[model samples]
Target: MTGKLVVGITGASGAIYAVRFLQHAAQYFDQLLVVMSQHARSVARAELGIEVGDGEQCAQNLLGRPYPNITFLN
Candidate 1:
């Protein structure tokens, strides 16, 4: 898939939505860049118990592996 995206996740307590979107879209998107804001981290920690201090790791866990198709920006 070829598209433009500016996905943003705030401190609303739902990282799964964004993570799931990336995993699902990775199947078709040629280039996927993820920009995870700082507030989202706390949300993940409070809601998901994933206090890793890195979006890449959380993303990998969500996708079940490392994918080169996505770029993670903390």
Candidate 2:
């Protein structure tokens, strides 16, 4: 409850679910380590109409904001 959490997301149909989970999880965890697959961006764009960018902008693009406690793993 007071530690880090690692979340892995693939090229699934329901990308919104992952996004929602991360949003809620961020409140409970100290840090969030997100690992997204190559095709995850495409799925997100198709399903949620969100552009999951690269590098430091990935989280921002996915969550639609900046979260200091979130980190993307490559």
Candidate 3:
């Protein structure tokens, strides 16, 4: 209940779901390690109109805010 969580985002059709899940998960988890696929960025842009960048910016782009507990993996 009070630990880390790993979330993976792929180039699937439902990016909004991932975004929403991450937002809620951040509130409960101590740390969030996010692994995003290479095509996920393109899918995010196409579906959610978000420009996902590298490193920390990627998190902000997806979540629309900065979450200190969330870390994006390369």
Best by TM-score: 3
Each prediction's Cα RMSD?
Answer: 2.4, 1.1, 1.1
Q: Using lDDT, give the best candidate's number.
A: 3
User: Any runs in candidate 1 off by more than 4 Å, and if so which?
Assistant: 55-58
- By lDDT, rank the candidates, best first: 3, 2, 1
Number of the candidate with higher TM-score, 1 or 2? 2
Q: Per-residue lDDT for 1-74 in model 2, tens only?
A: 58999999999789989988988898899999999997887899999888887788887899988877889988
User: Model 1 TM-score?
Assistant: 0.72
Q: Estimate each model's TM-score.
A: 0.72, 0.91, 0.93
What local lDDT score does residue 18 receive in model 3, on the 0 to 100 scale? 91
| Overall lDDT per candidate, in order of appearance | 0.69, 0.88, 0.89
Give the per-residue lDDT of model 3 (tens digit) for 1-74. Answer: 38999988888888889999999999999999999997888888898899888887877888988999999998
True lDDT of residue 21, candidate 2: 92
lDDT, candidate 1, equals 0.69
lDDT of 3: 0.89
